[model samples]
Target: MKKVINNPENVVNEMVEGFIAAFGNDYKKVHHTNGVVIKNKPNRVAVVTGGGSGHEPLFIGMVGEGLADGAAIGNVFAAPTPNTVLEVTKELDSGQGVLYVYGNYSGDVLNFDMAAELAELEDITTKTVLVNDDVASATKEHAFDRRGIAGDIFAIKIAGAAANDNLTLEEVARITQKAANHTRSIGVALSPSSIPSTGKYTFEIADDEIELGMGIHGEPGVKRTKLQTADELTANMLDYIFDDIELQENDEVCVLVNGLGSTTLMELFIVNRKVVEILNEKGISIYDTDVNSYCTTLEMAGVSITLMKLDDELKNYYDKPAYSPYYFKKGRG
Candidate 1:
């Protein structure tokens, strides 16, 4: 396996050290832990989310003034330990309480639950909103039980804004759940990524093949077929998502077309253009649009599209100002 690194075992630690060196002054690392909290003492409801590494600008990238107050880092594709999450919660807790938002993977659910239990011993009230926005994970009949994917960005942004607006913990949790319910995501992978330590691809895909509905961690998707043009790929994904969500004309939505690591910005934009065209033809109004490599699967080459059905309340919170390493917007601008 060809990669740029010192040692496979030390990649996570080294990368994290470099991350701190680049942005540590803007944030503070929790002592003896793989976590970071906002430099400013949190005066409002604290927000925290995390999972395995490899998906940069995810849990950590969202740590800033208007996003998560703290993030617990885990190993590549592995959930953070309960102790690590507990420490982060303790460090970020203000008198107001905290909200935990994370994907619906089993490991995360288990570890965060343990961390929440630990925090309860200290009388630090905590609540969690599981993100299950991957439409490919399940049908509408099982939407609430599906796995989470790129839609997490919207959930974090909305919840963070609520917290920044001085909403109580319960309110933030409610807002986050609402965002999750309104959001849907579907992804296609052209290539697989290698786990640093394993020195092997997490999954295998033929050179001219693509996997639809694949999970971020190389989980099996709905189907595999020969690679199609960008327009065809986008249509296939959007059709599945629209059918699942039952989006209608005159619906206002926020669109996110995200790269899964190795895809080029130009390619993502090409896909986004087609996505916008199709949505417009259907009379769906886009309230806002973001296209970037916000979430990734190591060096996998693919992209996911997320559409969040928006109402006035969701739009208000989404438009609120946010500044994180990965996302930035002026307040009410």
Candidate 2:
């Protein structure tokens, strides 16, 4: 195993420290905890989302004025401890209450559930909405029960906008779940990623091969085949997404063409162009589009396409203002 690090156990702690050091003014670390909360606590609903590391700009980068109120950091590919989540809840909670939004991963489910229980004992109101938007991960018979992926960004963004509008915790959670249900995602990986601690590729594929339906953690994909051109790849990804969701003409949709990690913006743009062309051919209008690296797999080379079938309400929230380290939007109103 080849990696650059002092110790495997300290990787998470070190990464968290660096993150706080760089963004500490905008955020403050919870004393003796692996959590971060916004420096200025808004009196409206509080949003906290988190999970394992390696997927930076996710639970952490979303912490800002118009996004997550706090984030609980966990080890690479592992969930944060329940106590860590509780600390984050304590820091972000104003009198209004808190909403925990995160991916539908087993470790996250167990730990966040325990944290909610602990927070309730302190009289802190808490609710959770899991993101399960990877249509390629599982079929319709198991959509609600499948794993969450890059589509989580849409959930967090819409929910944060709801909270920014002073929606109740229940309302925020409801809207977040709605976004998750309405959204779907699919990804293809040209390469694998290495966990900092392990110093080995999480999964492997031949040089000319690609993995479809690949998870962020480098889990084995649904299928492996020779690589294709940008247009062909986009079609391969969208075919499953559009077929499964059955979007209709005139449907206003939000599209996210996300780079996993090492993939460049130039490549993403080429892929985005094809995606837009295909969607336009179907007469489906795009309400909003985000083509960037919103989610990642720690230096992995690949991209994921996410589609959110939006309604007027969702489009309104999505158009609202947002500012974060990795994302920014001017208020449309």
**What lDDT, from 0 to 1, does candidate 1 have?**
0.90
Q: In candidate 1, which residue pairs get closer than 3 Å at backbone N, Cα or C atoms, i.e. clash?
A: none
Indicate which candidate wins on TM-score: 1
| CA lDDT scores, all candidates in order | 0.90, 0.88
lDDT of 2 by residue, 1-333 (tens): 456677888987877788889988788888888788889878888999999988887878888867888889788878989999999998888878899888888899999999999999999999998998777677789886777888889988998899999998888888888888899999889988888766788887899999998989887678898999999999989998987887999998999999998899999999999999999999999988899988898889999999999987888888899988887878685
Q: Provide the TM-score for each candidate, comma-separated.
A: 0.98, 0.97
What are the per-residue Cα lDDT tens digits for candidate 1 across 239-275?
Answer: 9888878788999999999999999999999999999
Q: List clash counts for every candidate, in order.
A: 0, 0
- Backbone clashes, candidate 1: 0
Q: lDDT, candidate 2, residue 159?
A: 86
